[model samples]
Target: MSAMQLDAPQVYDVIVVGGGNAALCAALSAHKAGATVVILEAASREERGGNSRFAGTAFRAPHQGLAHVKTVLCEQALEDAERCSMSPYTPEDYRNDLQSTSHGRNDPLMSEIMIQDAWETIEWMKDKGVRWETTLRKYYNIETQKGIIIDLMSGAPVKVVGDGEGLIRDLYNAVENASIPVRYDCPAHELLTSGDTVYGVRTRQTDKYVDFYGQVLLACGGFSANPAMRRQYLGEGWDLVPVRGTRHNTGTMLRRAVEAGARPVGHWGAAHASPQDIDAPLTGDITKTPVIPRYSYTYGISVNVEGKRFFDEGEAEFGLTYAKIGKMIGDQPRAIAYQIFDQKTIYLLQTRYSSGRPIVADTIRELATKLDVNPTVLERTVQEFNAACPGADIGHFDPHHLDGLCTSSSLAIPKSNWALRLERGPFVAYGVTCGITFTYGGIASDDKARVLNNEGKAMPGLYCAGEIAGGVFYHNYAGGAGLTKGAVFGRIAGREAALRAKGAGGEAARFRPCKMEAAISSRRTA
Candidate 1:
């Protein structure tokens, strides 16, 4: 197909589409670099803060002191990436786990770039008022010799405070304070090109079409939340089964890029293993709170459609589990799973961990009946878990020994190693279902964050970062890597775009009418 052309006017140094982390980062970075910037966001008022906000809010990096553990995690991620590569995920393998998670479809050069500059980015975040719980050098250990990592928590030396909302708010505040213009409810429809170079974007506001010409950066997020787009990109049977993430991510900008001749880097999908009720719409009055505590402590067997356990119950990484559950959605009885725990579990979780909710039942049978699972199967699952207690050391169950589970820690007890036995009669069961968090596949770009056309040429004046750019990981995501990647790449794209815009003298070049018509005609014929 041929590229779609657009007529644009009113140029700025940089025009960033989308209001999420990547977009915001790009705009702020460009503005800080002394470029006039504008941000076009679809949402009038930020609701859930997009996927970045809803995330676990951790960033993963190699331990500074323990090179051995850091090296191990990196090697493992690379090995996994090599094993999972398809045609699109070329030269599959990564020196970083974060890159492996992107299926090796990410630009290796960019991945290296981000890894080298990660510490600096974290420091930049600190300077911007986001607090971290730890020092710049300290690492949060995961026990299994995974080594140390950085985190954003209060009271740490570099204390980077806030969740996704805090990060976004701070970024938005910085950009606004710098006098960057943000036009809400404005969505870019197409790229305006001049000769072989991209000049700017044609945008659609609520009431009419407006041309917002500049070096355009597409950060409008992924197609995971869009049911129709999911069906088109993933498969006929695939639907965006709702769970977490903002509703504004509909892949509109992705569609625009594809129409402009950009090639998507990856083909695989990624999702969050969410609670069952995640599909239900939030009541208007229901306030958003941290949901980690409930997820961290809840113990239950996850069964597939065949009524069998699929993986170790205590495993922290939920992507593979979610994918397995997602594959069973169209099967008989519409595959569902349940979480079985007791009152003690709920109470301990609520008292010790934050955000744990109650799901009480008078008895195991009542809980089974409430969850619509086979009573015998539920009983057997519990019995099996109990039989494997004190380490739950089933052959396949590889549990990460954290501080809470080790005998050395004050929080640890004799029964700490045991997966909650679920022996008490008065039980609580909550259902859980899987859903998409963000799209892994996106327009292929270079280390500078310039979007590449199908022919492997960078589209001048057009760039992208965050979920909109792909070819980073092969499979499996390390906690906090997504947010880190978004910020890192957004910064790159913004700086490069600003430089390009400044060079272009603020007036976007115009495409020759004859060539533009020919390109459009060829598309119609194709």
Candidate 2:
């Protein structure tokens, strides 16, 4: 028997699958571009806030000047990406980075499009009601001035705030004013495709299945919260790791896409480790203690299982640090490291660290005991660090005196007056666990944000943005770039998807599902 068809199809120009910044931008952009758009959000409108809303509202770029903005075009962005990328840079350097970071598994065409159009999208956002704060600096100065730095132009703001509620509120209000249909508590189960082209989406809502037809945008987010997908993509050990973002980002829609022949790209799970509560729930829990503030003037020095410091402690970018940390998991007992700090350090961190529980102890030994680490090792680590501070070098680990040393702890403070000792008792210790904010790896998309099939051709009526698009960066992520990429690319995808919908004709061939046995087996090795 033929499947029952709706006598009157509830048609739209496009259907957006997520409610985050990317999804919102895409839906709004498509609507403004003269397409009827509908947003199918898995959560209630009130609870629809995704990781974008909770982000540190900063937009990162290499060169900043209204005068030189044209010079810092797509080519310049691609070149800057190549300098820090892990893969051999290509003309499609951004796309290669996206795929290489995902271990050569993302859609290259989509990746290319997103990179190509990112700057224009940012400009469009500015044209629309988004305004960046003008007083921030765009660069970081390390000692000797030989380190990763983002060049900031004179009189230009380095970071921009989304007005948090204001940005989303405006988009939400605009979406409502447009009279776009939004189905809340409706979770898309799978894509209904007619061969190679997507036709619609099957959703599960209120214990009933509803089939909606239109071009679908899979913006449901990455699988950071799904334990099964986390284990499959990240690793088996990820079962113990806590998710630190929205719970609705379960990757359900992504699974459906993959099942329909959409190749996965950029699968590495990069995350932000919170020091407050170990393995805490993604939402809720604010602790009051002598712990360091969130995002304050703080630097990180990570130690391995051997209690030896590895990597530059001052590197503030969490994505870069997590890529390094992902290498050390299961290396030794505890498989953990303590973020060493004192009272002043606590105050500094209090300004930056957002949500996490903190542990307080009066001595290094006491702090070590509370964390179940070796007291002698911890003490020696502190002493050696302190002694090395005089020469601005911590044993083999060189200390670039960008920030002064820990002065409160005498055991760890350098002899130099410039160095601050970690002497004061009641030392604070926060358990640092590898927590993921979002997945960096995803399907590769072009500058236009079109999702390409395994053969590297754009799939008609299919588009993606946000964390779903891969190949923007390879190893390092400057703060605020992810959100910028998402918002920018989402607009690109929305506009292009609307164009495709308007021009589409005839039934496209259905996608044949790939053999997953091999992919699953390969995942085991990954």
Candidate 3:
């Protein structure tokens, strides 16, 4: 919906730019804290949720047990969540996850903030009219292929009460109920700055540019959808990779912030990507984004267009290493891979989220033909994999924990785990390619989500959160953490910006500045 033309005030308390999980979270949080908040979204109302609408309803929030889930989720999901098995995700676990996932390159302060405040953010969302559900996982043991027990995800799996849409819906409801004006189809082209302070924004409206004055909170997301930025930062073949989220995330907000002197942080060349259907739409399909990725590749094996296996599919690090798998596929021949699963592992497929139509055949050779892979090479690959499978040291083929059932290392690319032979008939293959989720590089912000100037000091009246604010993620990422990061930091930025706009920090603390490289160097050393 378009922003209502209430009496034109000189400025709002908080002007949250962008519309998504993070932006909505910020707007609602600011409104709750007794501030006039306005949300500026680039897309039309129909496409306003941004990438979040295309994602699975999963969240990586901290929780104690099933009881905590029951309290947070809606009544409809309570029963399923209560019946589901879950483990408590301690703050330390979240910290370790960030460290291990980013190989310790993530900002320690920001990582700690996410781990420390994730639970609070989820609870805050619940208070803001949001609901949650258990992000239940299902991995079957090779012995129980008929589907007896499927392990929940290896670690804690927290699903939003509803997937992405539900999240945005609830948040939108809150915004609407609060009468927070959200100007759809209006994109903020640049920040309205006064010395070191950001007082408002220069927005491009229907047919003209309008100046929106306010203490700005940026939740505009990263530059993944920007073709030129992708080619420039991520290098060749990057622009060809389909975007798994919104086309509106053209890095406009990010580039604007950088031009305004915000220091960029995190991996410029890296992003959170995944293996999506080869024929899926250029951007994420609103109907099936969360389920589009060929994540179940760990249960099978993937072959490139040449009918030759690529990387070890089993390296699908249940928690952290999932991001690498996408780029791996992007780097392959024609940026395509075929995930093959035989009858033995057919029951293990989570095909409910499958993005594109599936190609099925009774035999491996037939499946190869349909997938356009060399049938002879496919046959040899399966045969060789089968020979080494029976001798694998895969104790019990347990799906709960890490089952070390590995293929022969002598092969060019071995399936590190879940090495089941494609001996059964009725095989299936899903052609897949990489789709970029969010970019890794973004404006540097503090734990409180205050935007940092190039000189390392906080930029007055400017705050950032969501994918637009970077630091924690690098090349790798955990599955549901994106939403959590957005919510947690969004809430923080909203609250902090609201307080600052309310004159809580005073003039002396408001206008601090430092030298450029020195500020970055000091932040680095800290």
Candidate 4:
């Protein structure tokens, strides 16, 4: 049996796989803990950051009030803070939201850790050079009568300065400042193990294979961008849905970990999905601000191809309901829908509406023609929706809160709240479809972010975090919770991996071929 060649003479204490917010957080934390760490990024420099780069940078953390959250805000955000109102987000609020959103199926221990450590992790990231701001523009309309109110009672009031891309830039800068080596275009294929303990990663650079021996931490993203995995796990039509993040997160590392005996958990059949502009790219562009989200559907009504209202457009606040709207839209006919709004609420749409071309018509018949729906059905649907409304004054319609003006319960699908009549013209509609952000199912890990085996035992020398660390969320997740969970567990995984590496006295100075490794290497070479 031939032994696999080591990549370099210097063995890193920790080998982090991925380059996005989670991976960077882990790498930074491990390095700060006095471990020699190296990051293996699948994407090149230009295409790094995983799903995090294209995400909205809102972070849902427990805070006292505006004063408490301002501790992590940047200079500019502080200057603009007085203009915005932020309701306090308590620990109980955070805990209940997580439990309720996951339908009480979330991992209890992991959820507790995230809930407790969320705020602290945000502060830690702030210390590491993350700039935050209280921006309601992404998820809320700014034209509210009470200036700009950010009601965190069920929303995320804060966001990164330049959004997700800005977050990646800051974290990358921190990684660089720490002098950690990040090997781009080097995607890890498998874990190198001796006995049941993973000690290194096997990656191919160009044509030849090379190995980096260390404590492996998989912060790589989920399988949203992998069409085959989507079909296999998330069901049939998921393969045709557009991705809202990086194309590099194809679940290679995740599959490798599972094949290596790590346990898979969470909602494999579910994901964090949202509505996107119909013409958006298959993989979202990170450089674009606001990306392709059309979350303002809460202020209007959506119809399927047959020109019929499907779900309650005003079911809940946009932040709480936006994530699941994509899945609902995907289940529609041809996986397409149109959000119709009148001049009364057209200006209430989020800024992301600028990315879409609105189909405008003086009448519902012409609009139905443009959307390729039945003209008569479209007109009737609108009339029924309008008739069901209580005819409340539009002036009392508060976009910041759930205004009690709902449609009559007698209708088949009543608009739950903020149900204003769509009477004024010219009416406008934006085409929409499902856009998947990340897969919820992934390798299961313990509270410390240590990977667990099928038997529910911790896998030695192996850790997982970020989207790859499953069970933190199930069917649905709160907005801004993704980044917060990633940061919290990523910090834990990094620190724990580093401490373990220190206990092991770092990586071995020389390579010795174990029977298992030798056999695997020989097969690969053949």
Q: Encode model 4's per-residue lDDT on 1-526: one tens digit a residue.
A: 4544444423688999999888999999999999999999999999888888887888888888888887888887776677666778888888888888889998889888887888889889999999988865565556643454445433475889888789999999999999999899988888887655787888877655677777899998999999999999989799999988998889998998988899999999999998888987887776552557898898889999999988988877777788888999999999999999998888777777877799999999999999899999999999899999988478778776788888997679989888998888899999999999998998889888999999999988899899998897887888888998889888989999999888877134333245435646565542
Q: Candidate 2: TM-score?
A: 0.71
| TM-score top scorer | 4
Candidate 1 or 2, higher TM-score? 1
Q: Which residue pairs in candidate 3 have backbone atoms (N, alpha carbon, C) closer than 3 angstroms, thus clashing?
A: 57-163, 132-161, 133-160, 133-161, 135-159
Cα lDDT tens digits for candidate 2, 228-270: 7777766657656655556788888777777777776663554
Report the number of the highest-lDDT candidate: 4
Q: Looking at model 4, report the run of 10 residues with the lowest lDDT sum.
A: 506-515
Residue runs of model 2 more than 4 Å from their true location after superposition: 1-9, 62-120, 134-167, 268-276, 282-311, 315-336, 343-347, 353-363, 390-426, 473-476, 505-526
lDDT of each: 0.57, 0.56, 0.77, 0.84
Higher-TM-score candidate of 3 and 4: 4
Residue range 370-399, candidate 1, lDDT tens digits: 666676776665565555564432343223
- Give, for candidate 2, the lowest lDDT window spanning 10 residues: 284-293
What lDDT is obtained when candidate 1 is compared to the true structure?
0.57
Q: Candidate 3 — worst ten consecutive residues by lDDT sum?
A: 508-517
